[model samples]
Target chain A: MQLKPGGIAATIGALAAGLVALPAAAQQQQQDAPSVAPGNAYDQSASDVDALVADSAVLYYQEDGGRVRAVEAETGLAWTGADGLAVSGRFTYDSLTGATPNGATRARYDQDFIGPLPAGGHLPAADTRTGASGAYTAPAGTLPVDPHFKDQRKAGDLGLTLPARAGFRLSLGGNASWESDYTSWSWRVGLAKDLFDKNTTLSLGYNYEHDESKPITGIPMPLGSMGDPAIGKQRIKRVDSLVLGITQVLTPAWLVQFNWSTGNSRGYHTDPYKLVTLTDRDSGDPFFYVYESRPRRRIRNSLFLASKLALGSYVTDATARWYHDSWGITAWTFGLSEHLPAGRSAYVEPLVRYYHQSKADFFRNYLLLDEPTPTYVSADSRLGAFGAWTFGLKGGVHLSDRVELYGSAQRYVQNGKRFYRDAPGTMAKVDLFAGSRSTSLVAGLRYHLR
Target chain B: MSVDRRLALLALTAGTLALAACAHDGAAPHLKLGARPWERDVLARKSMQLAVEPALLAFDDHTYFSKEAAAGGRGFDGGGCGCN
Candidate 1:
C-alpha cells in the first residue's frame, strides 16, 4: 500500500514501538521456547586468535516482458589478525542482457527508435556496445522496448582495519569498477570506538567517488533532439558521502543499530541513452524523442534504524528507514524477517520488505508539443512515485563443523502510483504504470577455519 | 561540496560527536549496558550479526539501484558500476 504524506512519521512511530517491546518479546520467547544456544562458545572476537570468514555467491535476476536479466557473481574474504588488524578483499562480475523499456510510452502508431551511427555501421545504429545498426520498431499500441541493451561490469574492493588504540579502530577502503560505457573509482575511511564494555559502538565514515561516463552512442546535450549532433564524448560525476553508525546492545539477546548518512552528487547526472518522446497533441503519434534531463546536483539524506532479537533458536529482525533528497523526493522503507532453526544443522528464513517513494520535482509521463519546455524535465519512471515489495525465503545447512551452504529466492514487485491527471491525446488513456516483475535466486557457500 | 551537503555533513559530525561524548561519560553504566562477557555466548551467534547475509545484501544494493531512487542508510557503499 502507498503511504500518504504523513505516513512516514507513522511508520517511524511503529518502529519505535517495536523497538520498545523487543525486550519484552525476548523475555517471553526465552520462557516459552527451548534454549538452543550452543554450549557457551561466543563471538570470534572473544578469542584473541587469527580468524577468516570467506564466502562466495552467484545470483540470477530476471524481469518479465523479456526485459533486463542479470547474472552476478561475487566472492569475498575477510581476515582478522590476532593482534586486532583486519584485512579484506572482494571481487564481483555482473552481466546484464535482454531488452529494457525505453521511457517512451506506447502510442497508436508504430514508432521507430533509432540510434547513433557507429564507426562502420549504417545510418542508424541500434546498439552502441555492439556497434550494430538497425531501427527497433515498436508495434502500434505496444510499449517501446530497446532490445539492444547489454553490458558487463567487473569490480573489486579492498579494505583494512587497524586498532588505533585500546577501544578505537580505523578503517580504509577502496573500490574500482569497469564497464563498457562507464568506470568509477572510490575510496573511504572510517573511525569507530567501543564504549560501555563494548556493548555500544559508534562509527563515522567518509566516502569519495569519481565516475566517468562515455555513453554508447556518444554523450548528447540534455533534453536535446535525438537527431542532433553529439555534444561530447564523455562526462564526469563525483559524489561525496558521510555516514554515522551506532550499534547498541539493548540486552543479552537483542541489539539495535541506528545509522545516518548523507551524500552530495555533482556533475553530469543524465542518462545519455534514455529519451522522452514528445507526442502530437491530438493524434497521440510520436512527434520527436529527446534525451531526458535532470538536475546536475543532488543532496540526499537518510535515517535508518534496525533491531535484531535473538530468542531461543529463532531470530527476528526489523528495520525502518526514512530518506529525502534535494530533488523533492522522499521515501520510506520497512523490512521484517524471521529465522527458524529447522533441525540440528539447518535453518530457514523468510523476509519481507516494503518501500515507498514520492515523485521527483520534474517527473512527467510525456511532454506535449504545445506546452512550453521546462527548465528541467524527465520521463524516467524511476523518478516517479511508486511502491515496491520484496518477499524472500532462504535456507541454509551446515555441511560440516566449518562449512555451510545456502540458497535464497526472492521476488520483487513495483507499482507506480497514478500521480498525473492530465495528458494530451490517447496518451491520457494508455496505462503508463507498467511496473516490473522480477525474481532473483542466489546460491553460495561459506567456510570458516582458524 | 554543495552548501546543503556541507551543512548536512556538519550536522552529521555534530551528532556523532554528541553521541560519542554521551557514551564516553558512562551514561548507561554497567547495569544498563548490554551483554556481559558471560552473556556474550548467545549474542555471538553468526545469526546475530547486523548483516546476516552480506552477499545477499550487496546484491540487493546493486539490484535496487536500478529500480529505486533511494540509497544510503545501512553502511558506506563504495560507488561502483554504471547503473542503468
Candidate 2:
C-alpha cells in the first residue's frame, strides 16, 4: 500500500516520537534491518562492511539511427579489515565506436578534410592529422560524421572507510581514468554519523576532480575564422564539490533520504571536437563552421530525495531531483522502481524515469552570420530544451547464498525542438530527435565470500 | 529571473521541503510489546536495501553523466572523460 501525503506526514511524526519513546513494540529488532547509513560517499552509511564481496558487470548500449554504440565492462571488490575498516577497489573499461554529431549543418557538397593525413595514420580518413581528418565528409543535405570515429577508456577507483568513535564513519575515495587524449583524477572524503538509535544518519562530503584533454587536432579556436591559430597544448579543467545529506528510517518499512550538493568548476568547458555551422541570414544556406565556446567558470547545485517503501514482499523505490547551473539551465528528474518476488530465490523489478530540462541561455543550433555574435554559444543538443523518458526491467537469481546473477534492459527516448528560434527565413530543416532513441543492456554477477 | 535569484529560490524551496519531510511530533510514540513484524522482515531483506546493486548502479551513473548535461547529486564526482 502506498502512503498518502497526509499519512506520510503522520508516519513521520510517529517516527520522531518513536525515536524518543523507544518503541517497545519492536518485536525482533532484526540485526539485518537496513541502517540509515549514507548510501554513498555523499551520503554516509553508518554500517560496517562485514563481508568480502566481488561484483562484475557488462553493458552494451546502442543509440538509434546509428549515432553511437558503446560496450563497457566493470568490476569491483570490497573487503573489511580488522577494527571495522573497509577497503574497496573498482576498474572499468569502455569502448565506444560510431558517429556523433559534429554540431555542423548538412553540407551542400562533399567536403574533404581541411588538411593532409599523418604518416602511419590509425584511422582510414586521408586527412588524419587535420581537424577534419576523422570527420565524415558529408554528402549534400546529410549530417556529417566521422564514420571511423572510435574511443576507448579505462578507469580505476580505490576507497577506504574507517569507523570512528561515537558512531562516526570516515570515507576516502580516489579515481583515475585514461583515454587516448584525455586523462582525469579525482578524490573525495566524507564523514557520517548515526544518531537516534541509528534511525537517522547525517553526512557531509567534499570532492575534487582534475581533467586534461588533448584532442586529436588540439584545441580549436572558438568562433575562430578559418586558418586561425590553434592551441596545441592540453587543456585542464577542475571541479570542487560539497554535499550534505541525511537518511532516515521513517518506519519499520519506510526509508527516506535527502541530499543537497553544490559544485564549482573552472577552466575550458568547450568541446574541442564539436563545431557549429554559420548560415546565411537571408538564404539559410550553410557558410562556415566554428567551434563552440562556454563560460570558463560554472556553478551548479542539485537537490535529491529518495524513498523506499516496503509492502509485504514487494518494495517500491522512488526518487526526485532538481538541478540548476549558472548557465541558466534547470532540470527536474523523477524515477520509480518496484521490486517483486517471482520465486523463492528470484525477483524482478520494473523501473521508469522522466527528465526535463530548460535550455541554456546561449544555446543555438546554428548561428546567423548577420546576427550579433554572442560571447558564449553552443549548438550542442545536450544544452537545448528537451525531455527524456526511460523504461526498463531488471531481474536477479540467487543461485546460492553466496552467488547472484542479475540482468537489465532499458530503452530511452528524448524529444526536443529542432530549431532554436523562429526566424522568418527558410532554414534547413533538421530532425533534432534523430538520435533520440537508445537501448541499454546490462548483465552482472555478485559473489560474497566469507 | 536571473540565475542567482533562481538558485536562491530553489535553495529555499528545497530547504522547506526537507524541513517538512522531517517534521515530527515533539513527543515520541511509545510502542507496546508485540506489534507485527512482517513489515520489518520484508525490510530486512537484502533485496530491500536501497543500494542492492552497487556495480550496476555505478555503471548507470557513468552512462548518464556522459550523455546528459546534468550531473552530481548523490556524491562522488570523479572525472572520467574529457567531453563528459
RMSD vs true structure, all candidates: 9.3, 11.8
What ranges in model 1 sit over 4 Å off? A1-49, A117-122, A126-134, A418-421, B1-31
Per-residue lDDT of candidate 1, residues A152-200 (tens digit)? 8899999999966978899999999998889999999999988766778
DockQ for each numbered candidate: 0.47, 0.26
Alpha carbon deviation, residue A94, candidate 1 (Å): 0.9
Alpha-carbon lDDT, every model: 0.76, 0.69
* Candidate 2: stretches off by over 4 Å: A1-49, A107-132, A419-421, A432-435, B1-42, B77-79
Docking class of 1: acceptable
- Listed in order, each prediction's TM-score against the native is 0.85, 0.82
Give the distance in Å from residue A260's predicted Cα in candidate 1 to where it truly belongs: 0.9
- Model 2 global lDDT (CA atoms, 0 to 1): 0.69
Candidate 2 per-residue lDDT over residues A1-450, each given as its tens digit: 111457434534543443322212121221233222322111222243578989887777778777677777889898987688889999988777667777676545664333112224334233332223353466766666656556778899999988677799999999899877789898999999875555567889998999888776657677764334465557888989888887777777787888888888998788876776787887767777777888898888888898888776677999998888899999998999998765345567899999888988988878888787789988787888889898998766555446656777789888876553454254545443323578887777778786
